[model samples]
Target: MNYFFSHFHVYRSSNMILLLFLLVLHQQHYFIKPIYAYSRVEDLAINCGTESNSIVLANKRIWIGDATNSKHFSVLESSPQKNQSSISVATPHRDDPYGTSRISHYEFTYSIHGVTPGHKFIKLHFNPASYPNFHPSKSVFSVKAGPYTLLRDFNASGAAQEHRDHHHHSDPNKILLIEYQHCIKVEPGQNLTLTFIPNTTHKDSYAFVNGIEVMSLFKYHDQCNKQKKSRFRFSEVVHHEESCMNCSPSAQPPPSQTKPASISGGVLYCVIAVSVFISMSSIFLLCIWVWRNSRMKHKAKMELIYEETTNSRKSSITLASGNSCRCFSIIEISAATINFDDIFVVGVGGFGKVYKGYIDDGTKPIAIKRFIPENGVQGVQEFKNEVEMLSQLSHPHLVPLIGYCNDEDDMIIVYDFMANGTLRDHLYGTCNTPLSWKQRLKICIGAGLGLEYLHSGAKFKIIHRDVKTSNILLDEEWVAKVSDFGLSKIGPNGESKFHVSTEVKGSLGYLDPEYSKTKRLTHKSDVYSFGVVLLEVLCGRAPLLRKVEGPKRCLVEWARSCQSEGPHAIDQMVDPFIRGKIVQECLSKFVEMALNCVVHEGNQRPSMGQVVEGLELALQLQLKSED
Candidate 1:
């Protein structure tokens, strides 16, 4: 009886403790608060988080304001891994109304690449959250100079809200409002990308202007711009005519006006018929003359421009596929580069430099790569191998070869120009704008898909010997397109491995140590390079880090050490700016995939197909949680 009583008491006590904890948790969660502003509509004040409160500048910090008290306001831009210091603005007076507060006029500085002079002012009045009657017929922001001038604001508040919260349509705090304006340029083709968070508002808010959305192709005809302008002019004429009619005196038939009405109508009809005939005839004649002149002039001008462009663009290739491949005349290549001006140079590599050039009457822009030629048949073998292999493969991720131009003086391979540049530039600051988290995730997935396609989807086995961030080019949508096939290897039919005992060639930090020593290249070698790139994505560190102790500091070595050290070890390895956002499961799987790719033995490493699968899984997991 004593033992039974003791056991029953203990069980009852545990149940009571759990019940008490549950009640406390329920109460705390149920009473959770939301932001509220009780001030009159006219009393509210709003401001942008920019230096000098000017919306014309690049760096906009953070948007923050208070409804009631004149408290110190703060905004912070911190490293991803560490807590950021607050940038506070002290209130001059404590007891001031919302609109009358000194917070109405403010200035601050935020640094991206450097400290740029800019401003953040309250350009508009009203908040989307509190002010239910907020509506603006028109809003405009002016630029200092250049082709971009004034931008007309458009409605972007709806899509902004819908997309931000996984289409749940329940997020009250999400700001769906987007202000927009038109972009102007002098190029033949107009390239525009409008990117905004889904769910909020505004259809006119473009993604490209904010540097958040990028894309690849803009295939507009040269005459399209002129045609569009003409259409706009025609529409303006019609609108003006309608507006004028409304303002004009009414033309009513009076009691004595019958005699003149028939004569006036007849005159007007005759005049309209004559004007139409003359206008049509003149337009036809002008079109014919312009076409003839442009065609004749274009042929001669194009040849001359091609000659000058190709000379400067085509750098000398040391290794030639002489006799084994077709070679063009030096004059032909010279016509492609327009005398190799500095503006044509796109990138430079150890073997040679790449240039942007237009060929075939300036209708196409091709990537002209000049490489060092080799002395023997191996050079010919490599060139033939790359071309033959590439011809057989077709995928959206891989760069397609239009053709190759090889002269005795220079060699050039043509590929479609990737407008958004490289993955390296996007992540680590290229041209100016830094990539957002959303862009980075999209880039990773695209790159993985490309690798997956090459490893398994391709007709024959093709290995991307140089798989680094630099090799990954981004399209307009920030989609990753892998390039650089100079060092690629093709496998024999039905045979996965074609044992090629050749000298190892690849980027320094990305080279597989085992392959380097053994001189046996395989698909696993490409896998190893991919692992280094994965590390870069996770840690935001360069493939090669300086070793304080010796010259042996590789990213893989450091990652291996971190794994055994502790969970925080990987934390230390992560890029400081983005540490908080790194999902643990995703990080773990990424690390695991990378390590599998970097195994001591080639056979042990996971294939590129598997690596891509793991990365996709990791990406899906991250997206689901963030949603």
Candidate 2:
């Protein structure tokens, strides 16, 4: 009896260990449950433009036709009298549910009802090819699911071409199919509505879709919540002439009926009770373990990052006002930006979007730059550099750094807002009022002063690696402030070291030819970029015009050629808005200074101080001319 009991104890211990091991593996996603294992509360697949009762695809999904729609959905058209039509494709790709598509010249909507509320995967299928009367190029549209804008001014042909180019396909005429997938949460009892609107800005534009699928996934709640915390909120609904049609009770499909299991009441009750208790106990223990492990890992990671940042040299630098830069929490940043709503977006750049936000109880206006790590390490390094450099340096002509947020995986920087926007906005783009010749001169002088300070006034010689009109911001008082220091670099510290040997990184067309060839960075490289900006301000044209051909494509080369031709040619190249406003002497001096800064050799370029003096002289000459 003792031997038998000892054997039983060993057996039970081994089984319990195995069970714990399996549970840990499941928590780590080592064991992926099959699709059929999920309790799918809702599944919808529509074969658009088809009249068939049912079609089974290769993926084992059953799709019903939307043409003879039952109570599940109702389609509303912008023009009920004209009515949108359906067309069949000549060649359909393999595994395609149906070759037909519903095409619309105007806006349309689909209201789907009776969907069990949760996070759903929304899929939209598109075939970029010519139809009977519709062409792929003209198929430009926007798609919206409730308040979320899935696609804005989307062009299927361009997307398909990009897909082909990405795969290195030489054949440009290949028919390509594309699918866009998005995940959205639907509150309980709320219906799902999808709107398709043609790009009204483009004439003769249309919208088309081949299929639509909406299915519930079991593990979407955590993912959706995380996404919401990281990204901006959904945009408002798109305004259109047609209104969305609501589904009535009679239009909804009949409730699904499930058969009851036949078993002895007493035995079934006991079995269910035991199963529920065991399952709940196991799940509760697993949750605790997972939570504790994740919490410990996250805490350690954050502490390491904080230690590194605090130990950095730049972090010790304090402002002249006796105030150091504050480290903001994610909650504070989110509150200031209103959870990064779309309406607060002021501008978009290579790194990410900039939001106009108010902080300190709406008293302090700030500009928040959210760094999105799209390029992985490069983006992260840039974010760190921006924080380090800006915190160490301060000047009246430089945009002030308010604070930063490096919580979790997010990287954000806050700055003093520039109410007047960028210099490029007034020079060529959309600003209705054009700056006078004198105003332009003053702005250039201010910007040059800022660069001079960075190059000489700072503790170490700093190079504004990227300098252009867009980076030159204007304030309410028209003071030109240099912004965007993500690419800025500290130049050689001692007199013996003339340049920093580093990889070339700057905007194209503004990049110095000598630096590009030698991989040597110096203040002269910034002078070269600033020279390009000088010409940009004078001609009111971009640094490089991709659409233009020959020397004219590059503003620097074209300006050089025009200067060689004489003052007459230079006058012709001037921006028409300020063509005759510039004095002859001022224009000649300005052109000479710009050309000297952009010479082929870095050593031949003017120093930042010299550039500042030249700009100041030009400004004085402009004032004399105005008098």
Candidate 3:
């Protein structure tokens, strides 16, 4: 009896130890298993509508074509024809995935299997081109991923045209490719299927795709965790996905995977109870550490960006007495702008929305420019540059900087409100009355003076790189002021420097051909852009009228052609509103000066000072003709 009792005691002790080990593993199973499974999964990129071999891009990403017959994806369509011809002109993308696309006249589906269960990034590539008998305009279709609607009645050609028009791209032959991206969640054992349905309501409508990319969210999270320098957060991507899904939860996991609960004895219950208490305590402590660490890191990053911007402008700020550019808090800005209500939005541009708000307790009016957060480093640089440049320089013709707000993720600039809005608003695209001949000449003179001040009168020579009508704002008295110094650059201080070699950046159609070709920016580059603005003022139209056909499509080319046809041909091109109002002599002198500013060589283009003087002369002639 003593021997048997001793052996039973040893067996019970061994059972207890094994039970504790099993309990610890059960507590961590949910967290550890998913991570391990995610690491094993890989990203996928497929070239659609092609039977060609796999393609290797410069970025070292291998893209498998549909012809590979990979188990990862299967197409419902039996025969998908490849794009007959490649894009004839140079495209924006470095890779040529757009060369071969899968075009379908009827509905089709792509069943993608083996995707790991998690949030995934879906990228659909499209090249809007005329494929064989398929017209680009007729390629209107809807896309769906399971229960989610990715796109509805989407027109690729219209979208491409809109993009071209927005950027003022004058080249009609330039191809515009598009890549639509979305984030989605996949449940366990659920295959991702993409369906492309043609719009049956529209006659001859079809669907096409150039490429498809499926990337796991864990891949981004893993990279983010590995690289301390990366600013992107996995949480932010998940937030974006949630927003894309309209804040709806993902579909429930398959019911077949659900397991039944089994009854346990009193001893097993006691083991589970102890494990639950210990596991909850450990998880709580870990979460606290992670949250604190993330907060500290985020704070440090924001401070770094702020410090860099402040340090770069220290010299400029010191020169300007430090108080010239005030710093406003986000709270004050939000209160003044009514929390950025749509009704308060006075203007919208590439940077962001401009809100007209009351500051200093509704006594003072201010124009607040909110920078788009997604603009990232480029937007930050612009914000810094504008503040640095504007703080040091002050002139009546230049818009006054009231203050700025760099609170948290918001980068905002406060400026003196212009009652009359932009010069473009008055020139066209509005019902505002056209300015008289003298008024137009005076506005031109004021704008020219602003550009001249930037080129010569400033403490340091500055070049207003983006000189366009839209950047010229008019005040209550109709006085023109140069605005948007984000693109401005400090030019050669003396004759010794000559030019600043930099990447070309300006609105298309107004970009200086010489500067674009050589990548050498100079004061004459601004002069060329101002010349385009001058043409805009004279013709009362945009720099490029996409609707106009042939040579008449481009204002500059059409103007040059008219000038070549003799002096009489030039008069026919004047804006009808000021047709007879302009003195012939004044018009001739103005046209000659404007043309001189846009000459082929920078050396041939007239200086900003000369432009100011010539405009003043034209104004004098107009006044003399009135007398």
Highest-scoring model, TM-score: 2
In model 2, which runs have C-alpha deviations exceeding 4 angstroms?
A: 1-322
- For candidate 2, report its TM-score: 0.53
Ranking by lDDT: 2, 3, 1
Off by over 4 Å in 1: 1-144, 147-333, 360-363, 372-383, 429-431, 492-499, 546-552
In the range 475-591, model 2's lDDT, one tens digit per residue, is: 878899999999999898756898999988898989999999999998999999999999999998788877667988899999999999999999999999999988998999999
lDDT of each: 0.52, 0.76, 0.75
Measured by lDDT, the strongest candidate is 2
lDDT of 3 by residue, 1-627 (tens): 564446456556656865896899988775564212333264788887666656565666667776568878887753345442222222233354665777776787888877777666677888777677678889899999887788888887776665555345555445667767666667678879898888989898888887888876433232111111101011000111112444456655556865654556666887677567556555655665697799999888877766765554344322266556778998888777656755456688899999877776565768899998656567777877887788888888999899898876788999998877788877765435667777777888899888899999988899888989989998888899999999889998766889999989999889999999999999999999999888888988788876768987888888899899987888888887898778889999999998888888999999988998999999888889879
Q: TM-score for all predictions? A: 0.48, 0.53, 0.52
Give every collision pair in model 3. none
Q: What are the clash counts of all predictions, listed in order? A: 66, 0, 0
Q: Which has the better TM-score: candidate 1, or candidate 2?
A: 2
On residues 287-312, what C-alpha lDDT tens digit does candidate 1 reach at each position? 65687799999787756655654554
